[model samples]
Every structure is written in C-alpha cells, then in structure tokens.
Target: MAEDTLVRVEHLAKKFCRDLKTSLWYGVQDLGAEFVGKKKEEDIQLRNKEFWAVRDINFELKRGECLGLIGRNGAGKSTLLKMLNGLIKPDKGRIEMYGRIGALIELGSGFNPILTGRENIYNNGSVLGLNKKEIDGLLEEIIDFSEMEKFIDTPVQYYSSGMKVRLGFSVAAHMKPDVLILDEVLAVGDSGFKIKSFNKINEIMRDAAVIFVSHSMPHIANITNKVLLMENGVVDYYGENITDGIERYFGLFAGDKERVEYNEFATIEDMKVYASAKYADDPSRKLPAIDYRDPIRIDLDLKLKPNVEWFHIKLQITDKDLKIVGIYDSFQFQEAIKNDRDLHHLKITIPNSIFIDGEYSITVFIQQRDPINSKWNLLAVYRYWRKFNMKASAGLGYVPAVVYLPGQCEVV
Candidate 1:
C-alpha cells in the first residue's frame, strides 16, 4: 500500500450458500470443528450450493480522494460495502485501513430501535469512539442537522425511513472520521434533505477519503473523481477518468443498442445516425466522431400494425453517466402522424451541435396515441441505440455544462 493510502483491499472474496438447509449444516460443521479445537477448512473454494458474492476485488483509496462504485443490482456492491464496514468477514484475502472509518452502510444500523432518538444518538456516538463529553458537545449539532428535534425524545422504532437516514448521515458526517463509506443512504432522503446531505459531504471532503456507491449517474459523476465499475462479483474497470468509467458502465447494456422489437402494434428498425459540417457535400454520412460545430441527423424506418391510428418518435441524448442531457421529440416538429400506412420512413435533423467533449448515448422512442385524448404515450424504448464520441476540441475551452446553448446576444 502507498504511504498516503487510507484504504487498501487485496483479492477480497465472500461467498454465500444458496440453500438454507445446506447453510445451516455447514454452520454446524464449522462450529463443531471450532469446539473440538480442529482447524476449519479454508473457504476459498465454493461448495455445491455456494456462490461467490464478491470475488478477487482490489482497490486503494488515498487521503482526500473519493472512489465511486457503480453497477447494476446484484452486482456485489452491497456485499463489498458490508465487508468494508467490518459487518462481515471475507472468505479470502484481506482489507487494510490506516485511519478511523465511519460507515453509513444500512440506515439506522447502530441505533437501538427501542431507545429514544436522543439516547440512540449518544449510543451511536459512543460506538464511533466518542466519549460522553465529546458526544454532549456534538449532540445538538446532530439533532439540528437531522431536523428531528421535535421527535428527538421519541423512540427510534417509530421514526420514518427518511428521518432515520437523516439522523444516521448526520452522525456519520459529524464524527469526522479519516475514511467515510456511504452506500445509497441518500436515496432514502427527500430532495431537500439530499441537497443538505450533499452540502455537508462537500464541507468535509477535504479531510477524509470517501467511498460512495450509487445508481444515479449524475450523482456519481458530480461527486467522485475516480471510479470503480464492477461486474458479476469482479472489478470491470478502475481508473481516474470517471467519464470513461461511466462509458464502460453504460456499455454493459449493449443489447439495447440499435435493436428492434416486434409486437402486436408496431415494429421499429433500421436506426441510423450521422453528423455533417455546415454545407457539407454529403450530409448523411456516418460520422466517426462528433464536433460541437457540426450538425447531427437520424433516420428511422418503421411499420405500423393494422388499426393503428397515430404514433410519435422521440430522440434523447444522454451523457457518459447515462443522465439525459437533451431530448427532442417529433411532436415538437409536427403533430402526430394521422395517415395510416403499413410502412413509414422518418428523417430527423439538428442543424447545430450543442455538445461538449464526452461520450453520448442516443435513445429512440416509439409511442402510440392515447385512444381517448390522442396524446402520445410511450409503447417502446430503445436505449443506447447509437453512441458517439465528442472531440475534446469540440469547444474552444472546457465547458462544465452538459450541452452548450447557442444564442445571439443583443444589447438593449
């Protein structure tokens, strides 16, 4: 490990049994072996009913750095977090930390449900290694941050999920540990509380190494400079360039790209994308890459089932983090298609580019008109149907905004 490293994990692995009976039997065997002074066999290999929840994981975190973990559900993120928080032990490998660690893994985990909120605060503080006098000084601050003063004396068992998360996060952040591990606790809070929580995290970011796990791409992209993308129980990508990491994360859903589905109502296919310079000779050629100064175009071929009355097409652009940055619908160009046809072709064009440097995903949507009101309603979705990269020189300078808005300036 590096001298400045706060957290280092090497080849850590964890496994679980699939069948309850088999797990119980294995537990009994292990306990009997321990009782008889016999060494238990190593758990490095899987048994008949066992599977690795997290395998061969490795990463390091330095002081004042944030590492973001991203993956789909059941991708071993929660399992790894449990191991980091010392709530569970790995079957193989080791994890070493050089600093005091504060973790907000499961909401209200350290709180005694039967205890009053005020008492739980002191208990949680003590668990975090704070003395009685130290907790007394921080008690009011924690209550204030949680906004639960009115219910501070009430039993924690009666608190709502949002209230519990607020209190839990307040304690973890205020404790000022050398390392912080947060796992989707923000997703439980409301929008207002989320904003406050983010503010508090930013305030303490300079003092601690943070590990964050979130499904929201925007939050991950905005909070962390380094990323670790995980796949089925293994590291897929780990690096400093968060944008490329995000791109690889989104690329996991490649099956959604340029694929068409057929149903009783309609079929959409032959999706294509192109970019062109202003007044270029060939306006529809596929672009190797996108320049912010060039225009973009899309073409789609579709067929409507008999008895279909009206339909709509929508184009959406998402960034490397899978956050929607731009959306333009055919309805904005014209009213719903009223003519009934067995087959139809559509061409959509944007005359100017508003993008900055990054990978982009283009999603296409096909919708059916509401039977009663005639408004467009989504019926099919094709996400990441096309992807394109924007050159770093797309803009003269680095633009922090998602898409640059072109406008004419006039002095009144």
Candidate 2:
C-alpha cells in the first residue's frame, strides 16, 4: 500500500448461506476446523445453499480521493461497505486500514436507542478515539451543524430517520477521521441537509478518503472522482472515468420494451426515428447514436377509425434520469389533420436538436381534439417508445444542462 492510501481492499469476498440451520451448521464446522488448525482451499468455495454476496472485489482509496460505489439494488454495495466499516468480516480476502475510520454506513448504526442524542454524540466521539475534552471542544459545532439542537437531549428512539441521518453525518464528518464511509444515508435527509452534507464532504475530501454509495447519478457525478460499478457481487466497471462509469451504470437498466396504451380511435402501425447527421451504430448500446445537435426525423404510420378528421401528436423527451427535458407538440405548428383515408403517414422533423450528449427516450401521445370542450382526448399513447444516444464533440464535457445552445459573449 502506498503511504497516501488510507484504505485498501484486496480480492475481498464474502458469502452467506440462505438457510438458517445450514448456516449455523456451516459456522460450527468452520469453528471446528479453526480449532483443529485444519484449513482447506475448498473452505472458501460456495457450498449448498450458499452464494457470494461480494466476490473478487479490489480497490484502493488514497487521501483526498472519493470513490462512488454505484449499482442496482441487491448488488452487494451495502455488504461491501459493511465489510469496509468492520461491521462484518470478509469470508475470503483482506482489507487494510490506516488511521481513524468514520462511517455512516447504516442509519443509527452507532447510536443506542435509549441514549439521548447528546449522549450518543459523545459516545460516537469516544468510539472514534476522541477524549472527553476533545469531544467537548467539538460538541457545540456538531450540534449546530446537525441543526437538531432542540432534540439534542431527546432519546434517539424518538428521532426521525432524517434526524438520525443529520446527527450521524454530523458526528462522522466532524470527527476528522482519515477515512469516511457513507452508504445512501443522506437520501433520507431533506434537500437543505443534503446540500450541507455535500458541502461538508467537499471540505473533508481535502484530506480524507471517502467511499460513497448512492443510486443517484447526479450526486455520484458531483462528489466522486472515481467510480466502481458493481453487479451481482462483482466489479462490472471500475475507473476514474466517471462519465463512462455513469453511462455503463445506465446501460444496466436499458432495453426498455415499447409500451402502448390502446384506444379505438387510432392505432400506431409503426414508428421510426432518423438523424440527418451520420449515425453510429454500436451493438453494445441499447439505443442508436447520432451526433449532438443533429437534425432528427420521426416517421409514424397510423390507422385511424373511419371518418376521423383530425388528431394531435406530441413527443416528450426525457433524459437518462427520466426527467422531462423537452416536448414537441404538433398542434403548435400544424392545423388539424384532414384524414382522406383510413391509413395515414406522418413525418415530424426537428431541424436543430438541442439535446446535449447523453441517453434520451421519447414518449409519444396521439390525441383527438374534442369538438365540444376544445380539449384533447387521448386516442393512443406510447410510453418510452424509443430511445437514442447523442454523441457530442470532445470539448463539451459533462454538460450540466439538459440542452446545449451555442452562444457568444462580448466584454462591455
């Protein structure tokens, strides 16, 4: 391990048995083997009803570095954090830790339910090796930072989840440990507290190593310099390229099937999307790729009910986070459609796409205008009907905005 490395994990693995009886029996057998000094290579291998919760994981975090641990639920992220925090022992490998470690891995993990919040603060401080006088010096700061001064004397059992998060983060961060481990505990905090926590994390990253686990990509992007993407108890991707890591994380949840809401007024026969600029087809990506700001064309084939005179089309574009970024309405530009036959072909063209570099999906709506109320009635709808990727030039890096618009600035 390098002198600057505060935490190091080598081929760390852990497993658990599904059945309680079998698990207890295995534990006894392992204890017997340990007592007799009988060790076998197969001991680390999975037995019946056993599975690896985390396997062959390797990573290192040095001072001033933050690692974002991201994956789908049940991907062994929490398990890995628990092992790092010494709450559980690894079954197969080793972990080296230097200096004091502060962790908010679980809500109220270090707090006693019967203890008052003030007492727990001192208790946690002492556990982190701070003397009573030193804790006294930091007590007021921690209390003020937590913003739970009113409830400082209240028993922890009465604290809400958010309150616990605030107090837990306050103690862990203020203790000034060399390594910090946080596991989605901030998600329970309110927006203001989250902001405060992130600010504190930034301040701590100047000297401490951090391992943060979160499902939110925005938070991961903002806080982590490196990323470790996990899947099925193993490393899926691990690198400093945060953008690539985020993209791969999004890829895990790709391949969304087209879902449509049916109605008797109209039926969509087929839909296709095209880009004016050169298209890049990558088999690994679930959606087709096009250059950023490329002109886009959407073609739709519809079968309408007899005598249906008009309908409106709407396109709602959402980013990978599933937040709506843009919308297109046919009624904004085109008049009511005059259906001459049962079958119709419609083409919508966006001459200049404003979408920045990222994955995006389109939701389509087909509606008929009610003659009496002048309101639109849905004839058919498509949820996440199509997905596409936009590849930008090298200069645009990690665009924080949803759309990119070229602009020129002049000094006055």
Candidate 3:
C-alpha cells in the first residue's frame, strides 16, 4: 500500500449461505479446519445454496479520492461496503486501513435507541477516538449542522427516518476521519439537507478518502473521481471514466415494454427512430446510438378506435434516470390529425436536438379534447415507447446539465 492510500482492498470476497442450518454447519466446518491449523479447499468454493455476495473486488483510495460504488439492487454493493467498514469479515482477501474511519452505512446504525441525541453524539465522538473536551468543542457545531438543536435532548427512538439521517450524517461529517464510507443515507434527508450534505462531502473529499455507494448517477458523477460498477457479486466495470461507467450502468437495464394507462383507446403499432440517413433498423441494438444534436425523426404507426376525432399528441423525452427532460406537443404545431381511417401514420421531426451526451427514452400520450368543457381526456399513454443513445459531439469533459446549447462568448 502507498503511504497516501487510506483504503486498500485486494481480491476481497465474501459469501453467505441461503439456509441458516447449512450456514451454521459450514461455520462449524470452517472452525474445525481453523482449529486443526489446516485450510479447507472448500472454503474457497461455493457449496449448495451458498453464493458470493461480493467476489474478487479490488480498489485503492488515496487521501484525496472519492470512489463511487454503483449498481442495481442486490448487486453486492452494500455487502462490499460492510466489509470495508469492518461490520462484516470477508471470507477471503485483505483490507488494509491506515487511519481513523467514519461510516454511515445504515441510518441510525451507530446510535443508541434509548440514548438522547446529545449523549449519542458524545458516544459517537468517543467511538471516533475524540476525547471529552474535543467532543465538547464540536457538540454545538454538530447540532447546528444537523438542524436538530430543538431535539438534541430527545431520545433517538423517537427520531424519524429523516431526523436519523440528519443526525447520523452530521456526526460523520464533523468527525473528519481519514476514510469515509457513506451508503445511500443522504437519500432520506430533505432537499435542503441533501444539498448541505453534498456540500460537506465536497469539503471532506479534499482531505479524506471516500467510498460512496449510490444508485443516483448524477450524485455518482458529481462526487466520484472513479467508479466501480458491480453486478452479481462481481466487478462488472471499474475505472476512472465516469461517463463510460454510467453508460454501462444504464445498459444493464433492459428497456421495459410499452405500457398503456387509462383508456386504451389507441395503441402504437410500430415506432422507429431515425438520425440523418441512418435508419435505426437493427433489432439487436437495444438503444441505437446517434451523434449529439443530430436531426431526429420519429415515425409512429397508431391504431385508433372508431369515433375518435381531433385528438392531440404529446411526446415526452426522458433521460436514463426516467426524469422528464423535455416535452413536445402537437398543439404547439397545430398539426391536424386526420382520423379518417382506423390506422394512422405520423412523422415527427426535431430540426436540431439540444440534448447532451447520454441515454434518453420517449413516451407518447394521446388525448382528446371535449368541445363543450375544453378539457383534454387522456385517451392513451405509451410509457417507455422508444429509447436512443446520443454520443458527444466533442470531448468537453463533464457537463452536469441535461441539455447542451451552443453559446457564444463576447469580450467587451
């Protein structure tokens, strides 16, 4: 390990048995082997009903680095974090730590339920190797940062989930440990507090090594210099290319089939996305990649019920996170919809897209306006109707915004 390295993991692996009885039996066998001063080959092999929660994971975090651990649920991210925090022992491999560690792996994990918040702060400070006078100096600051000064004397059992998160993160933030391990505890706090917490994390990253586990890509991209993507208890991708890591993480999700809601008065029979002369005709490509800001053309074939006339259409574009980025309405263009026959073919063109480099999906909505009330009735909704990928025009590094608009600078 380097002198500046605060956390180092080497081929770390851990396994668990599904059945309790079998787990106990395996434990006993492992104990017997240990007592006899002999290593069992089976220790490295998976038995029946046993699986590796985290396997062969290796990473090193030096003093001013933050590592993003991201993956789908049940991908062994939490398990790996627990091992690094010493909450659980690894079945194999080694973890080397150099200095004091602070971890917020679970909400209210280190708190005493019966103890008052004030007392818990002192207790946590003591656990972090801070003396009484040191903790006294930081007590008020911690309370203020947590925004729980009013409830400082209240018992922790009465704290809500958000309160617990605030208190827990406050202590961890102020402790200033050499290595910080944070799970998704920040997700529980309110928007203001989350913002505050990220700011604090930014401050800490300059002085300590951080291992942050989060499902939010924006958060991962914002804080982590490098990323480790896990899948099925193993390393799927690990590198400093945060964009590539995020793209691979999005690729793990199989695009959901089009979902209909409300009245199924219309159905999208076929949908195709086109960029320039290249027609997205490959069935194997889940999301066809296109150059950024390329003119996009969407062709949709819809089958509508009889008597449905003068209906409006809406196209909603969403990023890989399923967050709505932009929307286009047929009413804006005043494009008349001719429902003379039951089937209809509509082509929508985007002269130039402003979306940044990332994955995006489209959702379609069909509605009818009541002439008397002037209110629109949702006729159909096709969720996750189409998906596409946009490649960056040039390597401009990381632009946090969703859309990239061309701009000119003027020097006067």
Candidate 4:
C-alpha cells in the first residue's frame, strides 16, 4: 500500500446463492406433473445454488481523494461498502484502513427502529466513539440539522422514512471521521433535504476522503476528484476524474471498437454501437451540457434485425443536479415509423423554451412497440453530464432566458 493510501482493498470477493438449481429441478419436475396431475407434496424438494457476487477486486483510496464505485445492479456495490465498514467480511481478500471512519453505507444501516429518536442518537453516537458529554454537546445540532426536532422524543418508528435517513445522516455527518463512505443515500428524503444534505457532504469533503457509490453519474462527476471503475471483479480503470471511469464502464460491455456478431434477440442481433450519441467522437468532450434557453440535439443512426417492432425512443434532459428538465419520447413527440425496418436515422431536438436557467445533461432510452403502447426493449441507454458546452447558464451573453415569449414591455 502507498503511504498516501487511506484504505486499500486487495483480492476481495463475496458470493451468494444464484440460479436455484433445486428450483430448476422442481420446475422441471413440475413440467412432468402437468401431464400427471397436481404435484405430489412428498416427491418434491427445493434447491438453491450459490454464485459470486463480487470477485478478486482490488483498489486503494488516497487521502483526501474522492473515489467512485459504479456497476450494473447486483454488481456488488453495497456488498463492497459493507466490507469496507467492517460490517461484513469478504469471502476472499484483505482490506486495511488508517483512522476513525464514518459510513452511511445504506440509508439506515445502524438505527434501531424501536428506539426513540433521542435514544438512537446517543446509541449511534456512542458506537462512533463519542463520549456522553461529546454526544450531549452535539445532540441539539444533530436534531436541528436533521430537521427532526419535533420528533426527537418520539419513537423512530413513528418517524417517516426521510426523517430516519436525515437523523442517521446527521449523526454520521457530525462525527467527522478521517474517512467517509457514502452509498446512494442521496436518493432518499425530499429534494430540499437532499440539497441540504449534499451541502453538508461538501463541507466534510474538504478534508476527508470520500468513497461514493451512485447510479447518478452527474453527481459522481462533480464531486469525485478521482475515480476507479470496477467490472467483472477487477479494477478496470482508475483515474483523476469521473469521465475516464465512466468511459471504461461503457467499454466493458459496449466495446465500441469491436464487432460482435452474436446476440440472442434478433431485435438486437445487428445492433452495433459504432459510436455513442453522447460520444460521437472522444468521450472526454461528450459529457452533457445544456445551456438554458437553447436547443439540444441527439442524433441516432441504427440498423435493426428483422422481427423487431417499431421502436419507441425516449430522451430525457436533466439539470446538473440530476433533476429532470424535459422528456421527449418517440411515440409521444418525435419522428415515427410504421414498418419494422433494417435501419433508422432519427434525431431529437429540444427547443430552448423548456428549462429554467441551469447546468444540465442528457440520457436516452429506446424500446420497441406500436402506436398505442410500446413494450420497452432493454438494450438502449446513454448518459452524458460532465463534458459540455451544455451548461454555462446561457451565460455566453445569452440572458435570453429559457424562453423569449416576445411582446415584452419596457418595465412598467
């Protein structure tokens, strides 16, 4: 481990039951019973099998640096976080950390649902190594920060889910440990609270190294000074910023430079992603950047396999904060087609009138369907947020707000 490393993880692995073999056996057995009548209770037994959730992964967190963790669902982010916090032991590998740590690994991992908010505060604080006097000094500030003052004496069960998260985060935030690990806790609570919570996080970020896991790339880009991408149990890429990590993530499955000829679904058999709509060229410049009161365009060129339905596509624009700005769907508001064709050239153009002045980005989704209701196809997705002329608040002397709406008056 480097002297600058605050935490180091090497050859870590965790496994879980996957593809219940017994379920398959029973399911197969049931197929025979369809011809024989009701399944005989005495003859059937259920079975489950185990699989690796994470394997042979390795990485290090430098002091005062922000590291990101990203993978598809079930790729073991939460499992890795648990291992980092010493809440769970890895089936393989070792992790070493230097110093007092604070983690809000999940929304509410250490709380006692039955305890009063007041009691839980002390309990959690004590666990974090605060003496009773120290806890006392910080109690009121925690309650105030959480905005759960009214419910301080109430049982935590009586609190709403947001309240619980606020309380938990408030405690963790006040502890000010040497290292902090934040999972996707930002997804919880109301928008206003989320903003407040993020501000608090930024405060601690000045000194503590933060390990963040989120599906929200925009946040990852803005907050993380560095990144490490994990794929198939390996540290696929690690860099000075989030963009490099994201490109590495896309490359693992997309592999834009390679030609893949095999696909189980005919709808996607010929679907080769020559270049992403977001990354028409270099991905470093491809991050989403929507200027307020300006138009944005997403062009798509695709060749589809036969036996595919007319596809519906959706393009969503969001502010840098990862809030939705506008949604454009093919079936709802863009170009359309009636036949199952081999190729398509389509573009979605967003007029400047829709958004409030802010920094924003784009995400696209596509599915197959008819005019009435299109059943979604799973293969299409693209996200851009960090790279852009898309932001800048139209500050390029284009006050020109999100909309002109003509016929203006001269200040009555």
Candidate 5:
C-alpha cells in the first residue's frame, strides 16, 4: 500500500456454514490441523451446507475519499467490514490497511457494558493510538458532541441505544484515524443528533478515508464521492457515478416490486399499479415514468381478508432522502368506503406532475379507524415500486425537491 492509499482489498472472500453443528465441528478440525502443523486443503472447499458470505470482492480507498456501500440486507456488507477491520479473517485474498482505523460498525459494539461512558471514551481513544495527553485535549469536545455530559459518568449498560451511538460516533470522529468505517447505526438517534453526526462525518472526510454503509440513498449521495452496490455477496456495481449505482439497486427490486402478501393477521395482495396517466389506456402495460406535463395516476387492486370492515388507504411518495414529498389518503380525499368486499380497485390521480429530476418511490398504506377515538389505524403497508425518475428540465440547475409548485406572482 502507498501513502495515499489508506485501504486496499483484493479478491477478498468469506464463507459460513448453514448448520451450527457442522460449523463448530469444522472449527475443531481446523484447530486440530493447526496444532499438528498440517495444511488442510479441504478447509477452503465448501461442503454439504455452506455458502459464501462474501466472494471475490476488490476495491481501494485513498485519502479524503468516502466510499459508499449500498445493498439490501444480508448482502455480506458487515462481513466485509469485519474483515477490513481485522475482526475476522478473509477466507481468500489480501487486505492491506495503512493507518489508525476508527470503526463504529454496530450499536454498542465496542463499549464495555459495566464501564462508565467516560471510561469507555478513554479506552476507545487509547485503542486508537491516542496518548493520555491527546485524549485529555479532546475529552471535553467528545463529551459535548455526544450530548452525554449528564450521563458521562454513568455506566454504559444504563445508556440508551442512541446514547451509545452518539458517544461511539463522537469518539471515532475525534480520534482522527487515517480510515473510518461506519455502518447504518445512525438511525437509532433523533433527527437533531443525526444532523450533528452528518456534520461530524463531513468534517472527518476532509482528510481521512471513509467506508460508509447505509441503505439510505440520499445519505450516500450527499456524503460519498463513489458508490458500490452489492448483491448476493458480490459487488454488482462499483463506480464513481452515484446515480448509476442507485439505478442499478432500484432495478433489482423493480421486478415484481411488491412486499409480502400476508403479514401479522391481515392479507393484502395483487397490487398491480401504474405510474402515470399515459399507462392507463393499456393497464396491462408496465408502469411508465411520469412526464412533467402529464398527470400522476396510480391504480391499486386491493383485496382485504374476510371479516374486515372499513379501511383507509394512503399514497405517499418519497425522495432519495426518505422524506415524504407527496401524500394522499383515501379517507381524507373521500375516495372510497371500507366494505366487506373481498376485491376493491382504486385509481389515484395527481393533477400535475410537478417534480424535478430525481428518483422517487410510492408507498401505500392501509388503515382502519379506531372505534373509540376515530383515529386511523394502520393495517398494511407496501412500497409498490421505485422506478419513477422525473426528468430534468433544461434550465434548472438542481431541483432540490420532488415537486416544486410555482407560487402566485404577487410581490408587494
């Protein structure tokens, strides 16, 4: 590895056994082989019930670079990160890292449960190669940033998940490691703390290499200069183009883009839908993108389980940031009544397609009103599909929203 290259990974792979007994037995065999100073080639070969957790992955990170790792759950992201951080060894290939590394991989991952928060800070700082003087110089700032002043002396076991994340991130941020690795643990914090964490991440990215893993596309777009899309334990897409990588991820779920048919005590099914009015003429045709001049029409085929009375449905659209930009409710809009019918069809239309250039997703919610307070009760929810991308207009530099309505021209 060169001075500029902070982290380098080549042909990295990891495998795991499906059966716990088999895994433990294999571990024992490998230990015995090591004890006898004998090489076991069968250790690398997959047997009855085993699968690759991560396979043939390669990437490099340089100084001042933030590489975004985007993928669905169980795509071997955490395994790869564990390998890079020396928490686990790769089954094959090499990883060379050149500096002090700071990692916040999991919630409450490194903190000692019985230790005070203050002690944990000092402990983690020491682990990052900071001396006592250096830790003292940054102690106050770390406490202030974590917002754990009142509970700094309290045992970490009593701290909430959010408190641990705040303290963990603050310590990692201040350690000034040559490389930083962060997982999707920031969701445990409140919005205010999330903003502070993002700010600190930006501050660290000025000179350090960062590997950020998040399902949030907006966070990846805003913070990272490059993106890596993972699927089925392999790097499906790795490039500098964020949009392209996001599109590839969206495309993965677009085929039959619907959620589970039954969850909890209810059943919702066959939510075949359309994106814009143009597709309504041929309802069987695939949903198309909404043209700025056309109207947005979403057709839903809802079927309720027997014995269910009245239910309300809401349509909401969200940007990459996961912010709700457009929302409409069946009850609020006087669309339909909940009946005992097993089959129901709905068509929702927006008068104008007024969004700027960006990818958006449609989320549907089924609810019933509470008998006591008449408040809406959610029953089922689904993100129908997310292939909608409002094309950019020629003059607009960067439209910052899903839909921007022109206001009245009365400047008094």
Candidate 6:
C-alpha cells in the first residue's frame, strides 16, 4: 500500500447463505413427497439460495480524505466496514490498510459484557492492535474525553446505554488510527456531550481518512469531500461531495419529483415507496414552525390500494448538528386497519414531547402487519423504500427549546 493511500478495498465481495424458505414443514413435506419419489422444486430452490452482501466493490480512501457511504438499509456500507475492521472476513478479494485502524461499528460492539468499562476500553484498544502500554498512557485522556470518570470502574453491563457509547467512542477516538470508521455511534448521548463529540470528530476527520456511514444526508454532504452512493449491492454513483451523491441517489426513488409527496407509493406498479427527511410531513413547506412542545398535527388523504391492511412510517429525525436524533416506526405500535374501503382519510396527532427541536426528517412504508393466521392476501414487503433551515423563535437558538429547565439565573 502506498503511504498516500490509507486504505484500499480491491474487488471486495461477500456472500450470505440466506435460508429463505427452509422450515420444519419443508422437512416433513420433503419426506412425504420422497415417498412418491418426487423431489420438489421448493426444496431445490431453497438448497441453491444465496444472497450477495457485497459484490466486487472497489474503492480507495486517500490519507485525510473523508468518504460518505450513503444508501438504504442492508446496503454494503456496514459490511464493508466490518471487513475493514477484520471483524468479518470477506468471501472474496482483499482490503489493504496502513497504520492502526479504529472502528465504531456499533455501540460497545467489541467490548466484553462482563468486563468493567475501564477494562473494556483496554480490551477494545488491544483489538484495534493497540498495546497495553499505549492504552495505559492514554487511559486518563480516554476517561476524561468520554466523561465516564465516575462509572469507569463499574462493569459495562450496568452502565447506561449513553455511557457505554461514550466509553466505546472514547477508546476508538484515542486510538489515533490512520483510518476511522464511524457507524451511527453518536446516536446515544446527551446534548452537550454530543456537541463536544461532533467537535472531536471534526478534528479527527482532519487527520484520518474517515468512512462515515450515516442516514443524515446533509451531514454527509456538509462534512465529507467525497461521497460513495451505494444501492442494492453495488456503487450507484460517486460524487465530489455528499450533496451531489444524495441528490442523485434520491432521484432514483422519486417518481414525480414534486416538493409535496405526489403519491403515497413510490412506484404504483409494484407499490414501492421512497422518501427523504423533508417528506415526513409537508414537503412543500421547507421548515414549518411546528410547535415542538405541543402535539404535531397531520392529516393525509389515505387510500388503501386494493388489499392494503396496515401502514408503517419509518421516521428519522436529526438535530441541527446532523447527528441522528431518533428513528421511529408506526408499525412498532399500531395494528393494521382491516376495513376494505378504497380511500380513507387519516388525521393523527403525534405528541411532540418525544423529539427535541432540530429539524426532523421522516421516511414511510405501509405494509400489512402479519398475515399467517389473519390475512395472507397482502403480506407483501417492499424491498427498497428509502430538512432545511428553520427560523429560531425568540426563546430558542437553532432549534426550539423543547426542554424547560426548572431553575434559571437572575440577571444582575
């Protein structure tokens, strides 16, 4: 590997042996059908089932270059990261790297559950090819940066989710890797801490060749100098920056391309749908002054296309920092509506207490819940369905002050 190239992924490929339809019934049915000396096509199809997680993916990250990986879920971004980290071996091809590599695939992923946070930090450092002496030298810095001073001795098993994340991130950040891969690890942290973390990341991005996997388009576009847009299992497009790649990627999903959602379904022929952050509510309105503390009002002219039974909306909200605030889905809560009406109006109010004030984003997918015992008629799952400046009200800065502290300082 050249000194200028921090990491190079050459013809990388991965295969997943997906047991799509093998079941107890398949065994019993196979035995019964074998009595008649007939080999069923269903069993044969299941035997040959394989899914490609990544296919001949090739790319390079130059030293100090930030690369944004953007795509729908199940895209090869995370898999690529795992391969890079040596957590998972690629079935074909190779990844060449220079210098120590630091990765945050998931919150506390490499840590031993039984170990204390203090121990896990050292353990994760060792996994990243760091020596105990190195970890010891940087121990105080890691703890101080993570702000896990009080809970450092306690076993990570008892640590809060946010604390665990901070600890894990601190260890990775302190590793001083030539290459750093961040996969949505910033999702769990307090506001003030997250601000600090973002600043730290910016500092790191300046020195290391960073591979950032996130759903926040604006963040990617704003931070990274180059963007790799992936879909299915291949690179769809590459751009000079995040904004271009995202615009090109979403252009593939949108049918009419209207500011307002033209139709509920992304594609009527297959009933496919896709969306970005803005479309969760009214797309036409860039940044509406919605009362964050009060309930959010929404009304949609819903239509049950033929045998539709349920509706699910996958909503992702990001704060002003481009950090992912939360991801919510309606299917997690409500049951499907079973009435056979062609068109039904739905007016619902989401309690605004959940989200803090930064501009929220949303993506929607409507599906019939479960149909085994109930209704198997419309149990189809859609494969691929995938925010702007807001004025600050007087009381707040960028986002509305959803949080009201109990005490305040009196002006002297």
Indicate which candidate wins on lDDT: 2
lDDT of 2: 0.88
lDDT of 6 by residue, 278-323 (tens): 3456657544445434454444444555645455544444443335
After superposing candidate 4, which stretches have Cα over 4 Å from the reference? 1-4, 19-48, 250-412
TM-score of each: 0.79, 0.95, 0.92, 0.59, 0.75, 0.57
All models: lDDT?
Answer: 0.80, 0.88, 0.87, 0.66, 0.80, 0.65
Better of 2 and 6 by TM-score: 2
* Reference-based lDDT, residue 113, model 4: 78
Error of 6 at 259 (Å): 14
Best by TM-score: 2
Candidate 6: residue 197 lDDT (0-100): 71
lDDT of 5 by residue, 119-195 (tens): 99899988888889999999999999999999999999999999999999999888888899999999888999998
TM-score of 4: 0.59
Q: Candidate 3 or 4, higher TM-score?
A: 3
Please give the distance, in angstroms, between residue 130's alpha carbon in candidate 3 and its true position after superposition: 1.8
Ranking by TM-score: 2, 3, 1, 5, 4, 6
Off by over 4 Å in 2: 40-42, 280-286, 393-395
lDDT per residue (tens digit) for residues 1-412 in model 1: 5777899999899889999999999778767867997733353467789998899999999887899999888899999999998998887888998767878988888889999999988887788789999999988999999999999999999999999999889888888788888999789999999989887777777888899999877688777878999999999999887777776886686433455443446666577666444424544534346567676777888777666777788888887656788898877788887546667888878777678776687877878767688676666677677876665443243344677677799999
RMSD of 1: 5.1
lDDT tens digits, residue span 77-104, model 3: 9999998888998889999988889999
Candidate 3, after superposition: displacement of residue 201 in Å? 1.1
Model 4 error, position 97 (Å): 1.2
Candidate 1 ranges with C-alpha deviation above 4 Å: 1-3, 31-43, 255-271, 276-289, 300-347, 356-402, 406-412
State candidate 5's TM-score: 0.75
Clashes of each: 0, 0, 0, 7, 0, 2
Each candidate's root-mean-square deviation in Å? 5.1, 2.0, 2.4, 14.1, 6.3, 15.4
